[model samples]
Target: TRRHRCRTSASQCSFCEEYILWFSIAQDILKYISPRDEIKLPELELPNINELKQQQLKQQQQLLQQQQQQTLLQSARSSSKPKFTIEMSSGGDNQSTSSSLSLNNEEEVPANMNTIAPVPAAAVAAASTTPELKVENNPDAGIWITSQGVFYFKLNTLHIHLQFFYSVLKELDRIIDIDALYYLLCCLKLLILNDECLETAAKDNRGFLSYCLEKLLVPHIWKIFALGHGHLNECCVPLLLHALNYEPGKTALWNILERDFSSAHWKVRSSAGTRVIALYSLLKPKLIKNNYNVLSVLAYAFLNLITSIEDVEPTVSQKAMCSLETLGDASFKTVMCALEFQFDTVINDRSIILHRLSKLYTILLRNNSTIKILSWEFFLNRFDTLSIESQISMEESGELISPQSIGGFNTESEHFIRKLNQIRFAMAKTDSIKPISSSIRVPSHQRRTTTTVPRQTNVTSDKVETDSIGSFLSPETENSDRSTLQLLVNLLMKFMMKDDQNQVNDDRIMLKQQVTSNI
Candidate 1:
């Protein structure tokens, strides 16, 4: 009963009057720390190893006696010191002896070299005269190396797992070489548990990681950044990031972000930051969000992607970011929209897609950006009715729970709440910044650049065009319902896609008609 009562920690004691004696024993075995205490390493007293030395000395004495007896018997008939003494007797001058010993004095010489004396002339004659037989166990002087898992068998070192990627690169049959790259990615994912190891891996992966980073992870993120697609097979980005021990995305993942990611793309190689953001996004990028340098790069990366590229993929990135805002509860839709700056023709379709934007807000819940995004009142309006009891059922069935509707109890929304919540030190910076509504505005040229009611992109058209952003909603939405603005934008994008499909079908029809006419 007493033993059962003692459960968790050895430091605490569990006792009743019935178990007083057992409690006393537990107290003796288990020590408790007081608040003021600074526990030191236990002073353990191990038996002195001098006894082993003594035993060895005794064996050596017996060996010496036996040798001497043989020597005396042999000397009665002949005479000689042993063979090693002879081999060491390279009898040049004292200069040669000094030189041999002093050779490579980068470190101290072996002790035995100093102790061994020159061989007697008789010992030299022992081999030359009668072919002296010699034997030795070679127990005293040498090192033994063996492999234990990923690391060399060096018990003194604290390294738990260490293996080079190159070694594994050369595959051998039936041998599983340690994958340092995958291992490192794992280390990064467990950063919360192994932060020290994560940092170490970023450094160790410097050489080979670049090759994989460039060839694999970089492309994946860029595809996601610019293209918004990735295959979750073989090596998933999550697995790689986990092994890297990088914090979850948005936690400043760029700290371990590869500088060479740009080498894979002409655009990336053209500007290094482009590749980094692409690569950064692959690790889910939430890890490195706290880092100032990374944050700046992220901002720049967003600008480069949408402004210059005229493709559906750039729109995908914007869409993904909007979804991302949903995870964190922040409204990065504006920032993502801002990245659309500098585009030559402000394609009305690409300007905004409400479904995509709403998706961004949802994914925000999953990103490090989630908490920051959620601070807005816009998000709070979604689900305001459920109590805690209903909330549990909602979670069980994979139902929805909007951060906003959790009660809408607050007087002020997230934007206003956070503005004042910022540190007093940031007052100056805050004062200089304008509200999102005030700063964001469409340009006159942006209005002028509008083409006829944007139509769906007809890729099937034989007419060659360098670029296109399928058709979009009409400009007439200027008078549309404010609540439906998002829906209007989304519907336009859908229309563009549908137009692309129709163009493909129409081309098939015209081709069929032409073939029949020719026949």
Candidate 2:
């Protein structure tokens, strides 16, 4: 009949046939990918639910029959007991008579009574009690596979079963494919964004929230970087930003951005800069409030932004500048203070300091309001102080250091000074205060001595020249100069030494010629 129905509705049955084929393929694939230990055995048979039910019913019936037989036996034993007994004269005679009477009664009982013994208490209880059957309904019980081949759970159900969500996180960690991991991240982001209940659930389960924020999302940022680029801002950044809805997530994000901003990798720094901008934009409403806690967070963020403005990477620098611009009036003092601190601290790389100074000068030039707020006099004093220190060091060293040299004369410093002079001159024209001299003044005693030593031998002269050149050059030059000086010194000493044997021979020849002339 079923075959006839299928034949009559072939078009309707085609969909079912196709679905069966697809399901079979999926099962085969699952079997192929599954571990060897999990492989199924064809010879093993699974018990049917109906068979199990029937078996249970038969066992219960057997228990009921046994219980009924025990009850009948117990009643028969109670009724068959002797109602009255006859006694003899003496004690021994009475005992013998009673025993004979019990024996006679036992022999009179039916032979089937031998099989009707008392059942154990545990068996009786088992026979009396019935097994309870419970049915459980779980709507979100299975793994859901999407069209993209990503497996996930329903967002609405994730909050209900947190362990399943954690398992998803674990699976996400195991995924090596970038696209698959990214799809999973997108699903998580959707779960966070769409499920309003998750927030309350996360609040209730702080461990779950912390695990997702710190363990799952934060680590994935670096993992994504390690795997590939171009997806961080799209996949991880928005997810982290959205996660900032929770207080713990906000803290985690702050730590992440802070650590990444100073990362050794430029890519991490650039991404961090971009994240900071997004974070500020997202928190701007709360940041603008007069709350101290929020304001403190803003201060730390602004400090990181200011520090990034001098980043060697142009991407990071531009992002920092854009973030600062977005911050506008709120970050004015923080930026100024941070720049001041950076300028005061002498870093080994003068170029970085110069870069930061140049960026700040550009900002002041672009924004007139910034110029009004900054004290150009203080900067002039600081610049002059640094210039004097550099001059003293240069004069003491007695070598003309190149402006481009690290930890040496910084041309950017002079350029920044000129810009500061222009700003000072422009500002001084309005006020009566005289423009301070931007030129660095070296004390007469601190000046480098230029006295020349008298020229010695060629080797000595060469040694002096090499020494002077090597002093200003890098360490490699110093090594080469030392080697050359040793060679020249050894050659000069060899040339200056006399050959006593040859001198003695020439003296003897002179004496022989004189004696011959005399003869």
Candidate 3:
């Protein structure tokens, strides 16, 4: 029953006895370290894999060759023997005589078939190898990660699982070996990364894993920061993000992210800003409720982190802007609030801030058309007078409003207006295309021109012509005339589309008629 047979100076024994011998030695060492009968930690060491591999390979080859040699010997013996049969009577005496004769024929061989050679014990003990892991608790049952099935743990009801979380945190603190900590992280990652394991854990109504995630993970986030330094442990990001998904942990997440956003290093700030945007993708109205607007915190951070659109470090500004784009409708409210309270002083001095703010507003409008409509109504109806008053104030104080400020504002406003018009025209074109499928038809004259009267009959006097030409030239009427021309152009485009469709249909009918006549 020996897994590894090894000969000692006094006697031959199995590897199991040697293991027991070494295990007792380990226990003695633990006893020496023990203080006043305290429980000792058992640290197991692993054996060298190369030695085991060589020993196993040699054993396999020997087994195969031995099997082959035995097969050849059996063939030789059968070939040497004759294939003759000896008839025997049913009586016991005749049967015994026949059996004795067969045995007498086998006795003619020189060797005894019942004997086996003794195997020499191997020096290497392959069976004694064990995994290299330390356990502070029971040695018989090793450490394992088991999920308590729960999506989240309520703070009041966490008494059932809180102790487990505390125990893990305490053990983690005691572990000074970086390798052990790394293994611990890998084990937890298996818990979160495995979809099947996660589902099973959740279904089993075990909340220990969820409690560790919700309560223990964030407070211990600083440990990762210390170990990883400036670079974040990529393994922890998924868990951190997952924690943020739960409603209870968002506050803690916001605090940690805010701290990083304000770090002395720009790289950390950049990373935090990137996460802000990522978290924004998961933001919902429900998630943003209860006086916790992740978007607003994110918006404030976006503005706080970057000096201007043209920061000394362009990447920082770019990251902030990228995070800003996911702010949804919150962008509109933030911008309006800024314009009312913060803009007048800051806007005149830093043109880059104005430019970035306008870019964010444009993104918001492009995504939500209803916001655009609301914005127009709000600005035109509410802010018109305020804007006029501000303009007057600027005119009065030339020293405050520099040429650079005016130019930047005009440039940013122009870019936003261009984007707005492009979106509007695209919507118009799509609407026109959809309506083209309608069956309604109009007379050619009516479709070609909205005016019913003939040009000659409706001829205007010289004064009327002069007035019309002068009105087109007047600066006061320029906006109105431009809008009027746009309307007319749109109408003309629709009429052209109808004409093209009618001509195509008529050509198809004529071609069919000609084919029928020829037949």
Each prediction's TM-score against the native? 0.24, 0.30, 0.26
Rank the candidate models, highest lDDT first: 2, 3, 1
**Model 3, residue 92: C-alpha shift (Å):** 99
Q: Please identify which of the two predictions, 1 or 2, would achieve the higher lDDT against the true structure.
A: 2
**Judged by TM-score, which candidate is best?**
2
Worst 10 residues of 2 by lDDT: 431-440
**Higher TM-score: candidate 2 or 3?**
2
The list of candidate 1 runs beyond 4 A from truth reads 1-196, 199-236, 239-300, 310-519
Could you give me the TM-score of model 3 versus the true structure?
0.26
Query: What is the per-residue lDDT of model 1 for residues 37-117, given as tens digits with 9 covering 90 to 100?
Result: 322212221112344447668989999999999778657533443234335557656655665455435223453243233
> How do all the candidates rank in terms of TM-score, highest first?
2, 3, 1
The whole-model lDDT of each prediction reads 0.32, 0.44, 0.39
Badly placed stretches (over 4 Å) of model 2 are: 1-160, 176-178, 221-238, 262-271, 274-299, 311-519
Candidate 2 lDDT over residue span 1-519, tens digit each: 012234554354664455445534643553354333411111211133345557778989999999999889878877885544434334577776777678667855764254223233344344446544221222244322211121223445445535544554566566543444555564554444444324645655444465465556655654554443455335554454445444555465456655676577777766655655544433323223322223333344554555665566667667667655655543454444433332332222122333333444446456542322233233333444344434333544675452222222344565434433332322222221111111112223322243111123333544544433234434423443343343333333432343345544654575455434433
